[model samples]
Target: MSDALSEASDLSGDDSQDVMTPTELIAKLEEAWLNEKFSPELLKNKSEIVECVMEQLTHMEENLQRVRKGDVKASIHRMEIDRIRFVLSSYLRSRLQKIEKFFPHVLEKEKSRAEGDPSFLSPEEFAFAKEYMANTETYLKAVALRHMPPNLQTIDMLKAVPEPCLDSFVFLRVKERQENILVEPETDEQREYVVDLEEGSQHLMRYRTIAPLVASGAVQLI
Candidate 1:
């Protein structure tokens, strides 16, 4: 586990007094989200992390209010609180982008046989997405059915339609060298030598083939 994760793991809901500060918790969550091998357990614990952050934010707000009333020492804490809020917002934005990419599917109402890998998302997250999609579909259908043209009225909802994720070809830069890549090249000329990649090299290859390397941080997606 990375240092941030290790620190996060050490914290528990019951041990409120000894738990990491809100800033540290946010940092840990951010790092975990960046990792390709994000744990389902982390998703499960998201509520607890959010609760902690909210409590801290509430306290910060109280302090800021008091400072506005004449307390000067609380000014420093206000700056730190604002910084943490910015980081927390950024962290949420990154997760939102991923959720947006999948949109209604995250809500899961219509059910797509070709659902993308949920390995990166938690069960709770998937459930919440489905709920959001269901509500949106309900609202749009009610509104659009009246406003939309005759032919377009029967249009399939984006969530109900199963669209394939086009991630087959990917561009990436090597962050670390790999002495051997198990994947084989089909051509006869490439069969004689094993695949070797050096650091700082950039290439476009099959996303599935390089997924493990990306997860391991050996390569970064471009």
Candidate 2:
């Protein structure tokens, strides 16, 4: 369908030469899900992938509505829908947990971001974060802040929550070959080194070094 093709194109983000097929689209979602799961910090949001997958599921469901209840095709369609639904729900749930864990930091990042920047939080997520922030403030004020000195009454959520550990090491597979990646030493006793990333090679390295590569889709976190 035209609508489905359009949605798929949006996910490509570049290389509009071809719309991503359902299989490739699902692969992209799985990549996002695993990257979010393994990364120490919340990664860039992938709402476009979510939207496109939803489109695929909806189209299939619509087709199934005309099929008989006992039809084998109907059963197959239901299984496919459920499969994609599970992945979509899990990906969203993972992001929400991270938001709750680092809400203050999430809000701070969103607020300080410049105009025209891609938001770290989707609109729905922004609302959730705001509501969570309000509730937290109310509870803290009643439970502890009211009794503290005026200067100490204010809580800095950034300081209250732990930051994502960028220095942590991650296992990644290079999707595209890259040259001259800097690998920082774990201690001062060792010297820093640079290495070329060959396409299809897997590496275990500190995340901070290849965070940009991960974002660019040059590497995938297994």
| lDDT by residue (tens digit), candidate 2, 1-222 | 998777666553454355687788899999999898888777889877887788778778888888878998788879888988998999999999998988888898999999999998888999999999899989999999999999999988788889888899999999999999988887999999999999999999989999999899899998
Candidate 2: residue 97 Cα off by (Å): 0.9
Q: What is the lDDT of candidate 2?
A: 0.87
Which stretch of 10 consecutive residues in model 2 shows the poorest summed lDDT? 9-18
Clashing pairs for model 1 are 106-129, 106-130, 107-129, 107-130
Q: Could you tell me how far off, in angstroms, the CA of residue 37 lies in candidate 1 after the best superposition?
A: 15
- The ten-residue window of minimal lDDT in model 1 covers 36-45
* C-alpha positional error of residue 13 in candidate 2 after TM-score superposition, expressed in Å: 12
The residue pairs that clash in candidate 2, if any, are none
- The parts of candidate 1 lying over 4 Å away from their true place are 1-12, 15-23, 32-45, 63-72, 109-131, 139-222
Relative to the true structure, candidate 2 reaches a TM of 0.89
